[model samples]
Target: MITLYGSPLSGNTHKVRMALAFLGLPWDERLTDAAARQSDAFAALTPMRQIPLFVDGGLTLRDSQAILAYLAARYRPGDWDGHTPEERSAIALWLSHAANEIANGPAALRLARRFGLAIPEDHAAAVTARFLPVIEAHLERRDWLAGDRLTIADLAASPYLALMEDAGIDPADWPAIHGWTRRIAALPAFPAIPGWPGEGAN
Candidate 1:
């Protein structure tokens, strides 16, 4: 059985859950959070103690992007995994962007706004201002993030990007980015990011 350890409301965790849904794989989820990570049991599982941890049989994985890549390549094969060398590199680039830019930009802002996290609001705003347009401009030339079809890259990036409003930014300001997220939402197997823009997307 595949077991995912993370909080459902967490965008990082939610992305992994979305990948599992799209793969049409039935799995169990263990609710984990910041406090839960402090437990000795959790620490024994992963020294990193990060949420969005995936356990399939004996293999234990941390980080949402890594988990998504493993799921795509392992279970579904060519369905979501990149087909070409260039496509794989492109997907890797977006995965890095998700871990750095998207995580620090909108995701940090949402944490600060909703949970009063100590992140500097101004810095996060600057990051978002810089990050959103690049995606908008890039999507103007392509339908998906990597290759000609949907891949784990889109799944890795879209959750936090969809939460622009939660970070005090307007989705209307970036039509291409907005449309891209809506397209993900329209996917038959896409799971909604609860309370975010993708929640009731058509």
Candidate 2:
């Protein structure tokens, strides 16, 4: 069976869970705590000691974006992944955005606010101010972030954006982005993450 090591509160971990659900993959989740992550057993599995590690058969993967691509390519075939090279590149762009801007922006704000992380308030505010409008404008033009269909880009970026409320941001402030999230939550197999705003989404 595929094994997933993650925390329920982690948006990175939720990204993998949502991808697995979307791809119809079954996994045995091993929830990990901070102490467990530092344990020798966990360290042996992943030196980075990050949550949301994936192990299936002989393949081991880290990083939520990489894991999302792997799960889509291996299990979803032409469905969740992009088809043409340009389409794939477009998706890759958003995946990088997920790892960088989304992570540093909304996700970081959530982390700082809820978990008491050391991220600078001004920096998080600046990131939110800069990136949220970009996302809104992008969504204003297209329903999905990349390609004609939903791809890894949508899954990669949605988790953090869904938690915008937790970051002290209002979905009402960005209607297009908020509506786009409702569209994602409307997907047949979308998984719910704790403290995210998917409840009652259309």
Candidate 3:
């Protein structure tokens, strides 16, 4: 069985967990606090001291997005994976956007608020204002981000947006994103991650 190291509350960690559940893979979770990530043992797995490290069959992988892609490739294969050249590129694009714009914007603002980090209200408001509309626009027509079918891209992006409540961003304002969340929430075998109540909670 695979072992996942991270706290349940982490959005990045939740992405990997979502992927594992979506693929129907059984994994043992080793919950760790933020300080534990800096320990020597954990440091060896991720030099940057990040959470959501994956230990599987003698291989250790870090970075939540990278781990999700690795698991999808190693386990699901074929169209389930965005393995074709075009599919891979498209998946990569979504993952990059998630990590860069989404993470740095809404996710960061939400984390700052939830954890009582020293982020100015103006900064958080600015991030939420910019990111919410972008997400709303993209989700306007697509059921999923990368391919016609659900892929790692959806799993990668879900947790952060789902936690928008922490940043005081109302999903009610974006019907497209709200509908997309509902679609994702209905996925079979979807596991409930910490910080997000099950479907229809908000």
Candidate 4:
């Protein structure tokens, strides 16, 4: 069995959990607090002290996006794994966007606030202002980021986007984005993280 180390409230960690569920893989979860992550044992497994470390058999992996890709490739045999060249490229593009822009922008601001980190209100506001429009524009007519079907792109982006409420950005404000989120929530085998309530529970 696989062992996942991290807090469920973490977006990065949640993404991995979601992927595992989507792929129908059973794994053990080891919950770790922020302080526990700095311990010698955890640090030995993940030098960077990041959340969502995956240990399966003899292979150990870090980085949530990489874990998601690994799960999809290992468990999903068809298009869901992005078998075609164009599909693979599209998946890479969206994954990069999710990691760089969305994660760094709105997700970072919300996490800073949640963790009681010193974050300027104006800075959070700036992130929200910039992020909403980009997401709104992309979600305008598309059912999913890559195409009509659900893919890792949706899993990679959903957790952080689901927490937009914490940033004081109402899903109601962006109809397309709101609808997209609902669709993601309705996917089969979607796992609910321990700390996070079900969709819209917050």
Write down the lDDT of every candidate, Cα atoms only.
0.86, 0.85, 0.79, 0.78
Off by over 4 Å in 3: 119-125, 195-198
Q: List the residue pairs that clash in candidate 2.
A: none
Task: Give per-residue CA lDDT, model 2, range 1-202, as digits (tens).
Answer: 9999999888899889988887788999998988999999999998899978999989999999999888888877666777878888888888988988888888889888888888877887887799888889999999998877788898889888888888888888998888888888878888777655564752
Per-residue lDDT over 1-202 for candidate 3, one digit per residue giving the tens place of the 0 to 100 score: 8999988788888888888887788999998887798689878777988888899889999888889778788877755567688988888887887787777777878877888766666765776677678778988978887779888888887788877777667777877877776788788987776555456676
> After superposition on all CA atoms, what RMSD does each candidate show versus the true structure?
1.7, 1.6, 2.0, 2.4
lDDT of 4 by residue, 1-202 (tens): 9999978678888888888887787989999888999899999998889888999989999988888888877777445558688888888887987877777776777767666666666766676687778878988968887766888888888777777766556767777777777777667887765433355653
Give the best candidate by lDDT.
Answer: 1
Would you give me the overall lDDT of model 1? 0.86
TM-score per model over all chains: 0.93, 0.93, 0.90, 0.88
**Model 1 alpha-carbon miss at residue 180, Å:** 1.0
**Global Cα lDDT for candidate 4:** 0.78
* Model 4 residue pairs with clashes: none
Candidate 1 structure quality by residue, lDDT tens digits, 77-107: 7658777788788999999999999999999
**CA lDDT of 150 in candidate 3?**
86
Whole-model alpha-carbon lDDT for candidate 3: 0.79
